[model samples]
Structure formats: structure tokens, C-alpha cells
Target: MAKIVVALGGNALGKSPEEQLELVKSTSKSLVALIQKGHEVVISHGNGPQVGSINLGLNFAADHEQGPSFPFAECGAMSQAYIGYHLQQSLQNELHDLGIDKPVVTLVTQTLVDKEDEAFANPTKPIGLFYDKETADKVSEEKNYTFVEDSGRGYRRVVPSPQPIEIIEQTSIETLINAGNLVISGGGGGIPVYKDNNGDLHGVDAVIDKDKSSALLAANLKSEQLIILTAVDYIYINFGKDNQEVLTEVAVDEMKKYIDEDQFAKGSMLPKVEASLQFIENNPEGKVIITSLEKLDDALEGKVGTVIKK
Candidate 1:
């Protein structure tokens, strides 16, 4: 049996409570298939929209009712627990229906970051909602939040996006996986944080890319493959134009060339590609499967998605 780390993209869950649960019902079918095939799977997911919405609501409530604003780490923890709950419940039910008895649980995970990481000095990751220029300026002054114009889609509050250095609970995660338990942890990049000189852990106000963190976990776990599910079934060149072309398989050397050409969007595809590179570099015999959720099985079968290898 193969050990696989499946890094789910944003659709692992949805934005709303009810909608997210419903979506998981559909996703669970595919996940169950992987388990039935005897693959030891660990799950990590993205929380860009969900965490942003939670942070926005917390700020709005605090603004009107005098309640304290939710801290960034708290928002991330919320996303992890709830999203994991939905996934755990859905997957467990599907397993039961398949006559497979296995326990699935969600663990609130933490990722260690350097306190002096340079990204903290300049926050550039867009989060929360987009707002008009005038409203953005007002929020910047009143709330003291950084706002950056995102293409033509108004402005959003950008936070420091730090690199995930370590998974604090990796041992527990590995133990669970080794026992054939499906573990879901590292939600929203494992709640970015740092340790002080006194050894006390403190949460930082930053977002870590989920795919990047997943790659780190995959490397540490020494998994044979890192499967990243996104919106597209395959990586593309000149995306959205008439000249667009799909990439079926890309060697490490060739991926560097495309990266230099700026083929991937920085806000999205670029990080995914970069993460894939890191995983392949560490595990030379391992490979990365980048594809959409619907085509996961095909990607595994080498019939679809872009395979990145060293």
C-alpha cells in the first residue's frame, strides 16, 4: 500500500456551514475509494475563503458590539476545527457505509515559524473581502489594516505570508497514520506561530500557504507522493487565452524554465508549483500530482493532471 498525502484545495469544504457539509458528502466518495484501495492517506486543506469570512465577521461584530476582535490564529483554529469536523464526519460515514471500520479525526495543528522571518516585516498576502478604493482607505486608517488592490477586483487586507518550518504535532500525526487511521490536520497551514526564548509558543498574525505547508508535511512524513487538488485538472501555459496548452508531465528541469516564463499566477498556481518542486527535490524518487478534485483517480493512474518529478 502506498502512503499518500492529499492536499485538498479550497473546495475541500465550502464557505457556508450547510454548503460545506453538503460538498463533503460528494468528496467523501472519492476519499473512501483511496482508503479501500489500502492507501494510507493524510489530509490537509486550504482555508482562504473560510478563514477570511470568519475574520471579517469577527471584526464586524467587534466594531458594533464592543466585543474584542478575534485574533488571526484564533480564526485559523476555528477554520481547522470546523472544517476538520465536517470532513471527519463525512468520511467516517462513508467508510461505515462501505463496511469499512476505521476512525477518522481532525487535529488542531500548529506550525512553527521563525519570529524574525522577513515576511513579517512586509505583509503582502491578500485576505478577507475586497472593497472599493475609498472604503479601503477608510478601513486602512480606522482599522489599521494593510489593503492592497487585487488586479481589478477592489482591495483586500494583506497579511504576512510566512513559510511553514515545522509541524508541531507531526509525531502524533504519523502515529495515527501508521495505525491505519485517516488523519486530517494542518488546516490553513497549521495555524502559523512562533516560539519565544522562554519556549512559550505565540501565534503570529500571518497566513501560510496551505499547499506549501502540505508539501512540508509530505516531506517530513516521507510520503511517496503529494497530490494537490485545485480547480484545474492540469497545469496550463498561457492560461485563458487562445494559445493555452495543457501540461501533462513536467520534469524538474523543465518546470524551472516555465516558472521563469511566469506561466503560473503568483496568487494561485505559482505557490502550488513551488511546493511541488520542494517535495520532489527532497524525495527524489517521489512525485507530485497536480490536478482537480474530480480527476484525482485519473491523476493517480497517470491518465490526467500534471506530474512533476525530479
Candidate 2:
């Protein structure tokens, strides 16, 4: 059986609480199918919508004096725990229904990042709810927050997206997987942290790309395959253009060529491909599968999606 680390995109977990729970139920079912097929699965998921919601809630509450405000790291932790809760419950239920006796667990994971990472100097990762130009301008002026128009979807708060240097809970996660339990960790890029001058760890107001962190996790765990479930069935070059083409299979060198040519969007498929390359570089024998959650089974069967190898 191949050990796989599945990285779920933010879209796989819906935009709201109700939708997220329902979607995760379906996601769990799909995951259990993989288990039935003899794949040892470990899950990692994005929290773009969830953490954004939390940050917006906190901002609103603070603005209205309804509650005290918390830091970004705390908000990230909240997203991780709640999302993990939903996954644990749904996966356990699905496993039980399939007559598979296994424990589903989640760790409140933390990822170490460089204190002086260049990303901090230029915040680019968008988070929080979208706001109209007027509201966005007002918030920016009053709160000193950075808001950027995201793909013409309205302005959103952007934060530093640092690279994940290490997974603090790597040992525990490996132990759980080794013990035959399905594990979920590294939610919202594992709560970005950095080391202080005294060599103490401190939480930072930053986001880490989920796929990037998942690649690091998969490499650290020595997993043979890193399956990244996104909203698309395959990675495409010239994504929205008429000549756009889907790549069914790609090599690391070819992917790097496309990346150098700026074929992928920065905050979208680009990071996913970069993560895939990272994993493939670390484990030359490993494979990275990129596909939509709905087409997971077909992708696994080599009928759909894109596969990247060394």
C-alpha cells in the first residue's frame, strides 16, 4: 500500500460553516474510498475562507466593541481546530459506515518560518471577507490594514505569506500514521510561527501557503505520493486563454520551465505546482497528483487529472 498525503484546497471545504460541514462529509466519503483501496491516507487542508471569516468576525466584533480583539495567530488556531473537528467527526463516521475500524485524529499543528523571510516585507496572500472600494478604503485608513482587489472579486485584506520551514508536530503526526490511524494536520498552513532573538518561538501575523506546507509535511513523512485536490481536474497552461492546454503528465524539469515562463497564476495553480516540484525534488521516486476532489477516484485510477514525477 502506498502512503499518501492528501492536500485539500479551500474550495473543497466550503465557504461557510454549514456548507463546510456538508462538504467535508462528502470529502470524508471520498477519502474513505481511498482507504478501502489500500492507501494509507493523511489529510491536510486549506483555510482561506475559514480563517478569513474568523478574521473578519474578530474585526467586526472589535469595531462594534462587542468583544475584545485577538491576534491573527489566535484566529488561525481557531480555524484549524474547528476545521479539524469537522474532518475528524466526518471521517470517523464515514469510516464506521464502511466498517473500517480506525481512529481519525487532528493535531493543532505549528509550522516554523524564517523570521526574516522576504514575504514579510511584501504581503501578498489575501484573506478575510471582500469589501467594497469605499469600505475597503475606510478600513485601510482606520486600521492600517492592507487591502487588495483579488481577481476582481472585491478588495480583501492581504497578509504576509511566509514559507514554512518546519512542521513542529511532524513527529506526532508520523506516530499517528504509523499507528494505523488517519491523521489530519497542517490546517491553514500550520499556524505560522518564527523564532525570536532569544531562540523562543513566537506567533506571527502571517499566512503560509497550504500546498507548500503540505509538500513539506509529505516530504518529512516520507510519503510516496502527494495528492493535491483543487477545484480543477488538471493543471493548465495559459489557464483562461483560448490556447490553454491541460497537462495530463509532466516532469519536474518541464514544470520548472513553465513556472519560469510564468504560465501559472501566482496565488493559484502556481503554488500548487511549486509544492509538487518541492516534493518531487525531495523524494525522486515520489509522485504528485493534482485534481479536483470530485475526480479523486478517477485520478487515482490514472483516468484524469495531472500527475507530476521526477
Candidate 3:
């Protein structure tokens, strides 16, 4: 059986809780199909929209005297718990219906980041709700929050997007995976944390790219395959242009050259591509699968998606 780490993209989730649960029902079916075929799967997902909405709601409540203030890290934990709950429930039901004996578990994981990572000095990741300029300035002044005007949509809170150096609970995660458990973990690049002088971990206000975290986890777990589900069915060069070309199977050397070309967009396919590179670099024997969630069958059959390998 192949040990696979499936990193779900934003398309796997919905904007609201009710809708997200419904979407995961279908996602579970696809995942269970892999399990039935004798492949061990580990699931991880993006929480960009979910975490932002959660942080916004909680802070609003706290401001209204309805609850205690929640830091971004706490909100990250909350997002992981609830998302894992939904994924766990759906996977259990799906496996049960299929008469599979595998159990699903979600770990509220933490990722360690460098305290002096240059990203800390430059907080570029935008999170939480968008506010009017006046409101943003007021909040910035009162709460010491950084606000950036987001393409005229409105001003939004920005946080550091640091690199994930290590997965703190990797040993536990590997243990669970070894026991044939369907593990969901490293949610939203994990709650970013830093170690102090005494080696104690402290939570911080930052966002680590989920794609990078997924790659890190897969490499650490030593999985044979890392499947990244994005919105596109395949990686394309000159995307959205007349001369665009779809990449089917790319060797590590060729992929490195393609990565150097300005074909992939930074905010979208670039991170996914970069993460795939990291996985391949770290685990030379392993390969990566990148495609849309909608193309699961074809991707699994090697009829679609971009396969990166050494």
C-alpha cells in the first residue's frame, strides 16, 4: 500500500459552516475510494477563508463584551478543531457505509517558525475582515493592528507569513498513520509558534502558507506521494493565454527550469508548485501529484494532473 499525503486546496471547503460540511461529504467519498484501493491517506487542508472569518467573529464578540479576546493563534486552533471535527465525522460515516474499518482522527498541530524570520518584519499576509479606511485606521491606532488597503475592496488586517520550519507533533502524527488511521492534520499551516530562550513555545500572530506546511509534513512523514488538489485540472504554462500548455509528467530537472519561468502566478499556482518542488527535493524517491479536486479519478489513474518526480 502506498502512503499518501493528500493536501486539499481551498476549493475543498466552503465559505460557511453548513456549506463546508456538505462539501466534505463528497470529499470523503473520494478519499475513501483511495482507502478502499489499499492506499493509506493523510489529509490536510487550507483554512484561509475559515480562519479569517473565525478570527473576525471572535474579536467582534470580544469587542462587544460578549467573550474573551482571541488571538490569531487561538483562532487558528479553533479553526483546526472545528474543521477536523467536520472532516473526521464525514470520513467516519463514509468509511462505515463502505464497510471499511479505518478510523479517522484530526490533530491540532503546531508548526515552529524562526523568531527572526524576515517575514516577521514584513507582515504581508492579509487576514480577517475588511474594514473601511476610517475604521481600519481607528482599529490600527487602538489595537496596534496593521491594516493594508486591499485593492480598493477595503482595508484588511495583515500578518506575517513565515516559513514552517518543523512540525512539532510529527512523531505523534506518524504513529497514528502507522496504525492505519486516516489522519487529518497540519490544518492552515498549523498554529505558528516560536521557541523562546528556555525552549518554551509561544504562539504568535502569523500565517504560514498551507501548501508549504503540507509539503513539510509529507516529507517528514516520508510518504511516497503527496497529492496537492488545486482548482486547475493540471499545471499550465502561459496560463489563461492563447499559447498555454498543460504539463502532464515533469522530471525534477525540467520542473526546476519551468519554475524559473514566470508562468505560475504567485498568489495561486506558484505556492503549490514551489511546495511540490520542496517535497521532491527532500524525498527523492517520492513523487507529487498536482491537480484539481474535481479530477480525482483521472489524477489517480495517471490520466491527468502534473506528476513531478526525480
Candidate 4:
């Protein structure tokens, strides 16, 4: 059996409960196919839109009502649990329907980050939604949040995006994987936190890229393959124009060259590509697959998806 780490995209689980439920049902259909093929899977996922909405709603409530504002990490934890719940329940039912008795568990993972990480010096990672310059400035002043112009598309709040240094629950995850269990963990990039000098853990007000975190977990677990699900069926060069080209299989060296040329957008496909390259570099024999969720089965069969190797 192949050990694969699948990273679910942010939009896969919508903000609303009804919408998320439907999306999970559709996505689990393909994911179950892999389990049926005797592959043990550990899934990681992004919670951008969901957590953004949660934080926004909380901030709004705190402003109008007498409610207290929740910290960003707490909001991220909320997203991880609910999103993991939807995925776990949906995948469990799908597995049972397929007569696969493998139990699925959800872990609220805490990924370790460096307190002195350079990313903390410059918070360029955008979170939540975009607002007009005036509104953004007002919110930044009122809430003491950081604001930056995102690609000249008005202004948005940017936060530190720390790199994952370690997975605090990695031992438990490894045990579950060894026991023949399917696990869903590291949601929202595992609630970015850091250890103090005394070895105490505390949450930070930053978000870690889920794709990057997935690569870190895959490497830690020594998974044979990493699958990153996104909106595109294939990774493209010269995206969004008549000169767009689809890539089949790429090596690490060639990918680095493209990255050097700035072929991918910073907030979108670039992080995913970099994450794939990191996984390929760390696991020399392992492969990374980038494709849409609908074509996962075909991708696994070598019929589709952009596969990157070392």
C-alpha cells in the first residue's frame, strides 16, 4: 500500500455549513477511491476563506455587541475542527458505503514556528478580505492591524506567515498511520504556534501556508507521495493568456528556473509550486501531484495531473 499525503484546497470546504457538506460529499467520492486502492492517506487542508469569514464575523460582533473578540489562532482552531469534522464524517460514510472499515480520525494539530523567524519582521501575508484604502486604514488604526496594498488591488490586512518548524502532534499522527488508520490533520496549517525558552507553547497571530505545512508533514512522515488539490487541472506556464502552456512532468531544477522567472503568482500558484518543490527536494524518491479534485483518480492512474519529481 502506498502512503500518500493529500492537501485539500481552501475553497473545497466553503464557509456555510450546507455548502461545505455538499462539497465534502463530492470530494470524498474521489478520495475514497484511493483508500479502496489500499493506500493509507493522511490529509492536510487549508482554511483561508472559512477562517477569514469567522474572524471577520467575530470582529464585527465585538464591535457592535458586548462580546469579546477572539484571537486569530482561536478562530483558526475553530475552522480546523469544523472543517475536519465535515471531512471526517463525509469520508467515513463514503468508506463505509464502499465496505472499507478503515476508521478516520481528526487531529487538532499545532505546528511549531520559530519565535525569531524573519517572517515576523515583515508581515506580508494577506488574510481575510480586501477593503478600500480609507476603510483599510481606518480598520488598521482602530483594530491595530497591519494593512498593505495587495498587488495594487486596494488594501488588505497582512499578517506574518511563519514557516512550520515542527509538528507538535507528529508522534501521535505517526502512531495512527502505523496502526492502519486514515487521519485528517494539520488543518489551517496546524494553527501556527511557537515554543518559548521554557518549552511552553503559545499561539501566534500568523498564518502558515497550508501547502508548505503539508510538505513539512509529508517529509516528517516520509510519505511516498504528496498530492495538492487546487482549482486548476494542470500547472500552467504563462498563465491567464493565449500563451499558456501545460506542463506534464517537471524536475526540481527546471521548476526552480521557472520560479526564478516569476511564472507563478505569489499568493496563488507560486506557494503551491514551491511547496511541491520542497517536498520533492526533501523526499528525493517521492513525487508531488498538482491537479483538481475531480480528476484525482485519473491523476493517480498517471492519466492526468502535473507530476513533479526530483
Give a tens-digit lDDT track for model 4, residues 1-310.
8789999987545547898789889889888888877777889998876787788899789999858888878988998998999999999999899888888999999999998899888886666666899999899888898887654456767777788889899999999988877899999888988888899999988788899999999998888999998777899888867998999999999999999999987766888899998888899999999998777878988899899999
Regions of model 2 farther than 4 Å from truth: 130-139, 149-154
Give the residue spans of candidate 4 off by over 4 A. Answer: 129-157
Residue-wise lDDT of candidate 1 within 94-199, one digit each (tens)? 9999999899989899999887889899886667666899999998999798888764457878888888999999999988887878899899888998999898
Best by lDDT: 2
Q: Candidate 4 at 83: error in angstroms? A: 0.4
Q: lDDT tens string, model 2, 30-119?
A: 889889989889999988777888887887898899998877788889999999999999999998887899998889999999978999
Q: Give the distance in Å from residue 154's predicted Cα in candidate 1 to where it truly belongs.
A: 6.5
Which RMSD values do the candidates have, in order? 2.1, 1.7, 3.2, 2.4
- Model 3 score (lDDT): 0.85
Query: lDDT of all the models against the reference?
Result: 0.86, 0.89, 0.85, 0.86
lDDT by residue (tens digit), candidate 3, 185-277: 999889999999999999998877788999999998888999998667899887767898999999988877877887675545777888988
- Model 3: residues with Cα > 4 Å off, grouped in runs: 124-158
Residue 128 in model 4: lDDT:
69
TM-scores across all candidates?
0.92, 0.94, 0.88, 0.91
- As a TM-score, model 2 comes out at 0.94
